[model samples]
Target: MTDLLARHRAVLPSWMPLYYAEPIEIVSGSGRRVTDAAGRIYLDFFGGVLTTMVGYDVPEVREAVERQLRSGVAHTSTLYLIRQQVELAEKIARVSGIPDARVFFTNSGTEANEAALLVATNYRRSNQVLAVRNSYHGRSYAAMGVTGNRGWSASTLNPLNVSYLHSGDRLRGLFRHLSDADHIEAAAEDLREVLATQTAGEVACLIAEPIQGVGGFVHAPDGLFAALHKVLDERGILFISDEVQTGWGRTGDHFWGYQAHGVTPDLLTFAKGIGNGFALAGVVGRAEVLDSVEAVSFSTFGGNPISTAAGNAVLDYVLEHDLQANARRVGAILRDGLRAAAGRYPIVAEVRGRGLMLAVEFVRPGTVEPDPAVTTRVFEECRARGLLVGKGGLYGNAVRMGPPLTLTEDEAREGLEILVASIATVSAGEAVACGVSA
Candidate 1:
């Protein structure tokens, strides 16, 4: 499978997204490319859903893991102090903007989110969390309870008290066509009204993804969150920033996605890119929220020596080499190339996102209705040409790509050429199918 499946035991557990009729089994990778079982090498733009962050076969990460493995012991429980875990936690705290931050390691983003929810609910004495429309947090019942994207949500039987808001998605929502300032004001008013009418004034927290990942990379205008937070702040409702896809400078302009806005979240959850393919995730929150729990807490596998070692190496590589700046420079080039290509096709609805985290949505030629058929063709065409991208968004009409932050200028152009050509091919095919001249 190419694409990761979601929210069920019967479905193939979400691995890599598979758009091809015959799914390719990726056996190995180097740099920004992967090799399938058939020995077909292809440029990997999706980065295993943006998890293989620093590229394949990075020596620093490999060597760090090897050193930790050779240390003669690996499974010491969190009962004992682990030097690597402590060191990595210290580094993360420094990078995390949370004041007096306390870190709790988890094996994945879902667990990190669960931990954040636990702390927030405990501290605020409530389970009522405000979630934005089209937001995705995780797959656990607790996590899924707060999730707003119906595409990934499986059941409505939830334990947490969550209310949906219309502030996250701008492209398809009521305020999409409005100007930035007007959109901000309108959405903020909606939030204020929802708070006044929906639940008691003392809500637990508002959990959000700065850029909705599974919901098609949708985000509101700048300052929209700042305005929404003002209402939350007035009621003492905490804010949880889910940076699972938008953290670690993947968005180019900022290290954390929330940084793009002017305010800081009371708590934050992160995963996907921190370990560069290694299983590492955690929650960073203010001391009061974290220390509020009276019970002794520990995760047997979270922050295990091996994962933390890889995390240290990955963080070092990102900072020492300045890959964030690289993402900005190369992302601009990719966006420009995509914008120019979009001008040539009528089926392309929009090309949106920041830095390497970009998406292209497809729609019927003459209407706003999503065209998943054309989107599938474009995805398949890119694969036929040995370019591996991603397929996502609510209606499955958006193609997603986030090449490794280390992608070179030439590689960016190469992927862009293949992507644009695939769209051209698909668009022409659709044109001919409709009895129109291409």
Candidate 2:
């Protein structure tokens, strides 16, 4: 393990800081758990950042990939379609309900989002895009332009055609800023106001995460998405939902996060759980929007045999095992456990999320100020106790927990107990005191 780290440091590029991790070197992983090089097993609450939905190194997926590997991995462009790719695309479209949705595959979330942006731009023939503040799309040139994370320099990277507004405010402002005062109507007026500012037949796309996973797991307000769709209808603009984190049944009740809002996006992109841990992603769009950009779309390695196999296997495992329903049940248990823990500790600020995508926010006692130190302590203590969770949010003060949907109820309870003990210790500014010691 030491040799592996040394070799990586000696040969790898310097951009490694882009990914966040602790000092431990993970050696292998399996159902709801990962083993480090030191032979210590850690319960994984973050689930490969919510990617390994069915759990790590799933045998069925591995077998499918091995079978595909015997033939070939990469295919010759979309020039020759494989049966698996076609079958997978059809399955995704049928599940997504985008009306004859066409699939444009990619290798990562950013590329999926990039493809969605291109479809939106070409279909509308407009350059301007609207996105919410703190929203994270991806870290590509165009995708980053629409991302609202202040740390990533998206604002300075591409200054034009990208407007930042609060999540709810983005939709509301877009309605009100585009039209005159008399035409404006309550909160819905903001959308009209912004759309009016763009040139006639302009404003290409409006992209947002169904649940802002990276941006604090912030759920869009009820009725807000449907209202946004109505405004988009009025202006003939495209609506894109970036489902990289919230897709593939991690959100509990629905397979796709947007389904929770009872709204369908003109363009939707997916990654993460589609391939479980393998490199796979895709952009699916309404037939009308997709057909408009059909000629312009092409990728060398997208939808290759191996990736398609992994994706199909993941879908099969998720459905066969009823992981979505498990996510709902386990998520409720986890949330209830966290709330109970919070009641026993005053430093806990709030707990928010749905299904398996949950977060426990920490704040300084007696004030609402974010407590990053407390969060760090909680994370470190959990890691020391053989449980691995993640931290995120604009303030870096929320303990993010999105374990694999395959997590057993017993395992989930054990992890929660460790977390509760850690939080209690951290919030009190001391370690647990054994009764025998005193």
Candidate 3:
């Protein structure tokens, strides 16, 4: 079977990008480690793009899924009663501190965003949605329309209702379009002016990622959202927080990324770590906002018994173990280690992000030009040394590391050592094992 899978991949062109696949096939995973078909084990710092919050194949999650399977009820229509779904929704809402919120489940993050767009536009009868440039929402047509990454999505330039607000100044170029004190006032004023010029009651929502995930993990400018939120609130515009990537304790200090900014979104979306690997996504919003479209909104596999069971188990484990506290502890260690490594290496331009959701920017040794080639080399070297990471940022030169919240200090240090060595070797132009292209 392994040989057959290898042969199948061999027939495909090497240049064919399989959405970050790196010429390797995995056979199994357990507890932050994956075993490739060749029996090579690797530490998975990427956490399946920060979705595997509880680590790979956690026994608690497995046991919950198995228990649900034995009950002869897994997937079910939303038309019927599902106790687990309600319980899961309550748990998520309680943790999020948004009491007057309703939860709508979906199969993935993109689907969650799709439902949000529908709810925001249709319920309010508005035509415009303002998002951040370089923000990533999802890949479906409507969700893709809101996402601002040009390389990830094709720019059809159709008459979509969504418009984007660009960040004002670059924060040292490692990050972009950031705002300072004066810039924050200017950006807020600019947005207010734009809203005033638009047709009355036309803008439905102003969507944003509390911490821009695929947009290079850029946090919003200081006081940017607080100032902007005032304008949106005055205009009765809904604030939507896309927490698909930053929710469920990936930010360490806060359960939800928006908490770091001290804002409560009218509508919030979540996926990834909420299920800890099981397929699930959700949209939580104010009761009034949700009630506006309750009669019209629908999803088939939104909140299945099995998925909700898994979600319940994930939440139980998180709270029981205080995983959010763990995330805070381990994240500090990771940030310090990576930042120190960055300070030591000239090739590493910046190490930025809060908590475990961190990234190291690769640049020209003495300049700000993005060094994608060097990044590609470093990724390959890291893979050879039994560590797995991810890449993002506008230029694809940021090495993103979002390990499971369950990772211990020792494990975090081990992963950092592997990354440090990989960067050092790649900087010296040494050959990396199991070479793969970006």
Candidate 4:
């Protein structure tokens, strides 16, 4: 290992996951490509965990942030009025689809979700929350409590009582054999049962990710959440859409993933791609719901002028360039290419995800068993070939790709070619060791 890697191991927590057998240090990036410490250029399919929405080294975002830095003001606590913060909030509220929307900004997705939970429990006067199976919200105590994926959840202790409901993952669920419509009905029924038997019938809210990010980009059938919304509406439970990964037009089909389900959530949390790598996240909801917090609350560095300036620029670029439509067009191309590769590779058990956030699942040939060993080998193979991707799943057997929404057709094709070749190399048992040491 490099000296830096050794130092990282010595200082960072052991549970913090690192990619590659030999972790690489990225030095710089432009567009969808990044250069590592060794000066090797690789196509960045992971997009810094889907945070670099407009791509790295975007001039617009850079200029905005630089301008903010040049200004005499930097840290204005939430107590003071900030113009950039107000402008970004107005833009977010307008696009959020919530009637009479109000926004509360936070420094990260975890904090944003925590604030949402605070508002929700306080508003409903209940500490009971409903979450989806195989979902990941954030890393805070409250966020991790609602997370269903065992690999990501670090503890069993929780601040609130959380009940897991069946989400739209039809592959391994109890209703896997049922039709799509039937599966939705079954999941909705399962949710109703949970609400009836698991809680006091007055739950705070239901938190969900339209597409499970850390769960390998797993998404439910369309309209699944809408169906469950009916149940929550009747019970007076709020709906919190965790769009940390699915927001900012990454899904291609809709600007917001919840739009695909045809439901307007009572609360929505956004991060990862909004500020184009800056620490910017927030909760948007109806004015009344946001105003339910009786105590005076403030975020020290949330919605800072610099970050808000970057957000405004990012939003402006997204609108002017129509990156959402680009995501749809290029995402369809990449998805088709991956599906074609799945047809050719026996180890590729399934290809899933919408728009740019996509995943390829690795399994034993002709069987449904997850093959994490082969998945690791394939990951190293891709790394050796100068292609960087991501990995996630309950079993750690899925390869995830969420390239920048600004990814071009040619770049998508090139990256797909490299991915398919890497998979082929690993499947043929011709892959070399990736220098992993214990």
Q: Pick the candidate with the highest lDDT.
A: 4
Q: Which stretches of candidate 2 lie over 4 Å from their true place?
A: 1-15, 18-22, 72-74, 168-187, 196-201, 430-438
RMSD of each candidate? Answer: 2.9, 5.0, 4.0, 3.2
Cα lDDT of model 1 by residue, 269-340, tens digit: 989888888889999999998888778777999998888999999999999988888899999888989998
Alpha-carbon deviation at 316 in model 4, angstroms: 1.0
Off by over 4 Å in 3: 1-16, 19-22, 155-159, 168-179, 196-201, 430-438
TM-score of candidate 2 relative to the true fold: 0.89
Go through the candidates in order and give each one's C-alpha lDDT. Answer: 0.87, 0.79, 0.81, 0.90
Model 2, 1-438: lDDT tens digits are 657767777998766642224467778998889998889999999887888888888899999999988876556567786788899999899888799788888999989988888888888887788887768888888888888877654446663387654553222223434333232233345566666764455788789887787766766555566677788787787889899999878888888888876789999999988888888898998888887874755787788888899999999888899888998888888889999878777678777788899988787665667788778888899998888888887677888988988988898899989999898778667323322210
Write down the worst ten-residue block by lDDT for model 2: 429-438
What root-mean-square deviation over C-alphas does model 2 reach?
Answer: 5.0
| Residue range 274-309, candidate 4, lDDT tens digits | 989999999999999999999989899999998999
Question: In candidate 1, how many Å is residue 383 off?
Answer: 0.8
Clashing pairs in 4: none
Write model 3 residue lDDT over 43-124, tens digit each, in one string.
9988888988899889999999999999998777888989989999998878776768788899899999888887888667
Q: Is candidate 1 or candidate 4 better by lDDT?
A: 4
Question: TM per model?
Answer: 0.95, 0.89, 0.91, 0.97
Worst 10 residues of 1 by lDDT: 1-10
